[model samples]
Target: MDTNTKAFIGESATTFATEIGIVIRNDCPMNFHKWDLIPEAMKTILYEKLEGKFQLLRTNKAFMKYVDGRLHAQWVRTRGALSRHWKENGGKTYPQRARLQVHSNCWSQDDWDHVCDYWELEKPRVSMLIIFYK
Candidate 1:
């Protein structure tokens, strides 16, 4: 695998998934812990807006995985959590892009520029899926 791919789905991270549903949270606190601060005020409310438009599912499965072979969990799935949220709360607002930053020591300007282009061209539009290869 390339160094760039290792960054998103950690090489060793195990992934657990099923068509019924997938839970992304794993043993490492890095993911869940960081997500803890996501403001509950917006949780149930925001999903409501995304319904019909998309589904946020938390699963161990992804299009790709890192070297270690672990799958991370996701918070929502299609017609899943967010779809349900909007039904409850139809009044809410959303941000255009969700910015995520990471520090790396290997990538050059060209590599990063390419990654940015990929993010916009592919990843989901709601959260701005970004991949910065290290």
Candidate 2:
């Protein structure tokens, strides 16, 4: 795909992942460990979001893969940012209320808490570390 298309897809995926964290917070299992396991409803919403801007994603496996990668990258980044924020502010020992700061403007406190809960799982922490180091 062209650079413009690639950039658009990446930006759209990030926006959807951050803005629609509520859909993910509600639809996904708290133990969710992988991006590929995202609920079909969430995936459909993303497809719909992208289709409005770029139709080729529907038929193009390569573009679809790129979108998936972008989504995963955003997920990782969001998780990392929250983790870092929590640590920098005061580690887990701090009161939950004090650590309830929203990681993004789009995320509500509940959404932030839910996503933080997901990252708290061992599977996600290990998987994220592997990806981060690689």
TM-score of each: 0.19, 0.57
lDDT by residue (tens digit), candidate 1, 35-121: 444454443343333222334332323422321122223433322332233323331222112112221311343432333333335
lDDT of 2 by residue, 1-134 (tens): 35555544456555545544544333333234567677867777755655554554556667677666655665555456566776665545563643466555224666666655554443533433445553
- CA lDDT, every prediction? 0.30, 0.55
lDDT of 2: 0.55
RMSD of each: 18.9, 7.3
Worst 10 residues of 1 by lDDT: 94-103
Count of steric clashes across candidates, in order: 23, 0
